[model samples]
Target chain A: MTSTNHTLFEDYLRGYISDEEKKRLELVLDSSETEREEFDLYKTMRRTLSPNIGNPYKERELKEHLEELGKKYTHEFSNEVMEMPVVRKAGYVRRILSVAASFTLVGLIGIAAMIPKNTSKALAQAYVYSSDSTAPSRSVNGDNLITSSEEYYLSGMQAFKEHKYETAIISTRKAKVGASPELIQEIEWLMALSELGLGNDAKAKELLTEISTDTKSDFSGEAKELLEDLNGIMHRISSFF
Target chain B: MPTAKTYLNGIKQTSHKVQHPDQKYIEALRTNDMILVEDIYKNYGQMITDLVKKNNGNAQDAMDLFQEVLIILHRYSQEGFTLTCSLKSFLYTLCKRRWINELKKKGRAETLKVADISDLNFAEESKESVEGTEMYDQRFRFCKEKFNLLSPGCKEIIQLSWRKQEDGKYCSWKEIAEELDMSYAYIRKKASQCKARLIELARKDPGFKNL
Candidate 1:
């Protein structure tokens, strides 16, 4: 009911309380249902939010790794679907649908061209890539021999700045191997930006989705903003059809 | 009735010990073993994609669902959870249940086309595991959401209070006090007050009962 009681509860939970204080606190908790319930909730919160010391970055690392796996497997699945057999009798029907689809695709493209170009692309272009706060800084002209990770990361950022998105993507992907958690987060952000600059919306969206979902990532806010823009464009396009 | 301490301790116990053959997958998730995790995706990824797509979802939705389910798996594995069924069955069951829940939330439940889960041999165990994990995940998420609603000062002190140092030991109040430029007594009291506020917020939520 009071801050003092909560402090006592905390002391007791952390085993910092003396025997007398612990007994008093237990008595108070036992006598009052409201206090007991509060203790339960507080205890649960402490347990739930306790940091994973063994691998503090497990979720972030796993998410990034799984994003790559998802991309690969999804691509394979799509190819498998394409290679699947179709009935010979439906060839004419398929041809007719193909013709209609072609016209629809052209019509959609024309409409897309007439509208203001996708705002997502504009937003992605305008997104300023900030360096990760946790990542260690290295001078480009440092006398020390650069490690592979550093080399790739530096080149990736260089390519990104030069507007060579394909090169940026390639360099960052190489940089991701054996990188620190901070560097991995930065590399993924860079890769997402490269994908966006190259107008590869699906890959950009996939990369952004992974980054945005991580609340602790440095680029999460920017990723979320870009994702919202991308989703808005997608919704508008889908609704038009 | 058991006291809160006993109840909390019970949850912390290694409740299940009969490890299934699929326990390796849980370990892979917990340890962030990228190669094993990729193997998990290679083996079960298509199955999940098919499950989601069959239920009116797209590739992106399927990907999102897969990542989410993996997160749940990771959490349970961290808590010393033992697999009583095959990982595939457990994952498939969780995904299937979660997809349905998503559809229900979106008011598109009627459009859900159920996948054939008849071949999943450990149906009851899988269902029970899914339910338990869902409840645990929901409760944690609810409390975390409430924790985020506290004042900035409250959140910071509470976070820094139990934060681990390089040696993997929790920071003492004195250390936290120095870090925050406050007295030890003040830091401890602030963290306690903040924690109390967080718990109170959770208790006051309309969905507290559900959690």
Candidate 2:
């Protein structure tokens, strides 16, 4: 270990060394063991003293940056956001879905706040999407999958929840277009289940078979199980016939 | 101009690499040489985001990875290191290192056998950045905390001067003077003074010193 080096020495080591001084320091480093050790200690101390400055854009900075970037992409953003299947945008889905999904999550602080929370209808609508009957209009000419059609799917989800088996079929079928292949299978499963619930085993079997083939994971596995139940229902129906 | 041309050439030559660097829109990133590193965030950003997301991380992980790899590349440059592999590969290796260290720190270290080697190999001629990226990352965080404590004016002047390099030679004293609208000597002197104050601040903070 060497004796203390001053702040000037620290600065020089902190990339503040001049060309002449750099040469001189190099000579000094070569000249003696004590000088080398001193320089080494100084280097270590400067590095130890040097605070690692992070990159300029921190998380909040990036968030602001993203907002700025988002503005530039506004046309792209609005077009995509409007096309989002979830209906709600990134920052505000919860409030809209709260009243929309059902009145179940709506606490006792209810219709006194506004329209009364319809508990029975909301509960019955729990398993299914309620039907709005409006199919999102698709414009294939412009590569637009009719956006107007989602109303049916949303309604079907609500209708299934309310145990409206017949209405659930109509709403879900109407909402079925423009969804990805996976959701198509899911909608098929829902439709089949509702039909079986309404005692239409033959129609249920055909729809359930369609869902079983979409096989891509847990959801498909459940569809397969339901299909087996539908087959069992078919055997009983045939026996009665 | 020669150095800029050389870097541009370096970018062009890297096209055939195992990992292609993305550089179609370089001007978006505020960089002295966006030409060299443009492909970096574009090619590897999502892969990192996906990796982190898979491991219970989030967009914050992507930010950390992006910044740390940059600091690592900058430090290597300050040490006169050369690039061997395409920038894409080097960035991939550096980001993976940062992510691995972060996971270990989180106390749920699951070192998956991620199959990615194209980015880890550097040209044999370029100096190894085999060390101190982790250290610099910590140091940078410390410096940033201290930076928050500095006078706004000091922070501004320091950042402006720090970004003055164009072809990696401080652009020009005259240009900087014009930009700052001050005499050349004044710009140089004020920059030094601001840097000195930054050092003093760093020196005093125990956390900064640890980094």
Candidate 3:
């Protein structure tokens, strides 16, 4: 079908066309089975893609709800699988491996304690978003609408607020790619906060440095203050060593 | 013979059987009923996790596939699709097919260790439902893929144009044009051209013929 007819058919399907236009479109569609088929496809697409009718936001919520349920079930499933006799029976080699694993875990805990921790996390607890934080507003301006990046960024922020720091970091990193400069700043700020939430103080400090040094960044002022606080926390922690 | 309307509506029906008892699952999905949804996981979730785990996948993969399948089912349910077969058979078949396709996409098709499902012997009605849902899922994915490829401006315009206002009316092109700081004619033409491009892309796809 011609592009004109395609648009007309869409308009008719969307109820954007007048009765005359609808009649004209129907006459054109009546000319061939192919036309009708193409029109039907458009109709299907409309039915499927129409935001109000399809209620994509609700679909997303449902998907998230399902993901949570899936996670819970799979966690239980994994536990059940682990409890099976075949998996549970330990041989001599397995017993030895377990002993070594215990020693390794103890050594790792000692090393982790020696490393400065919790200070950054404490600092981040203040900087990171809470349930009281306002939700990200929808981008109304067409020029600013990078839908995927916006979606990822929003999800990242949501994860951050929920204390899913690892998920927040992953999502924010994805949002960083191909994002606008302004969005990149927001993403970087969130990433730094997520790193701090994860207790990766060095990574958080590095991200904060980048944002603070960028004069044009919206988060520069806050990042700079957080960097100073982070430094003081590190300084106090290092004094113990 | 099923015409375009039948295809547009849903899968062709061979029988007017009573709706399966498990139709509640579909309804639960549509309404986002948490109790029934959890029951879905309680009853059949293990089967999917086991299926994925045995086929070089982890619990996470199973979880992702499970969510995708639920979303697809929910979309079809919204389209008034009826459940003639048991939801278990339908979900199992759909997950198996989707996992295989996912494996292919990941270049692990050769490593797909899923046992031959033919022996399970899905009835004709279940097979039909699974196929129809898969087709609908594919078409939805295709449309989204094309929609994402549109210019950022076009995407925003199309999104805003189709989105309903608080009062339950689609935002007029003129309102969208003003919001986007563009002339009405330019906005209208852009929206039309954007939709045409999407349709044209779908039409040009060789796979669309079978769909």
Q: Write the per-residue lDDT of candidate 1 for residues A73-126, one digit (tens) a residue.
A: 764542232211122445888899989999999998888777765553454556
Per-model TM-score versus the true fold: 0.60, 0.36, 0.55
Give Cα distance to truth, residue B124, candidate 1, Å: 2.7
Candidate 3 residue lDDT tens string, B123-176: 344887888787777877777777778888877877887677768677776788
Predicted complex 3: CAPRI docking category = incorrect
Candidate 1 local Cα displacement, residue B111, angstroms: 3.6
How do the residues B1-211 of candidate 2 rate in per-residue lDDT, one tens digit apiece? 1221232233235234232223222212333344334344445555555554444343444555665555444543432233434444455556666677777875445634344433223322122433434454565456566666778866765555444243543334466678778898776666556555665666676664364
Task: Give the residue spans of candidate 3 off by over 4 A.
Answer: A1-7, A15-18, A32-38, A51-55, A81-241, B1-18, B102-125, B164-169, B178-183
Q: Supply the DockQ value of model 1.
A: 0.20
Tens digits of per-residue lDDT for model 3, A1-241: 5666655665665578797976666665566787888777676566566652335677888878887787567657643442111225569998999999999999877866887554655667677644133245546124664578878998988877777665677688778777877778778888888878765565578789999999998788889989887778564564333
What residue runs in model 1 are displaced by over 4 Å at the alpha carbon? A52-56, A81-241, B13-17, B115-122, B165-168
Residue A234 CA displacement from its true place in model 2, Å? 27
Q: Which tens-of-lDDT digit does each residue in B23-128 have in candidate 1? A: 8988998878888888888777777776665565544567778888887778767666677777777887888888888988866677565533353443566776
Residue B10 lDDT, candidate 3, scale 0-100: 51
Best by DockQ: 1
**Interface root-mean-square deviation (Å) of every model:** 6.4, 13.7, 7.2
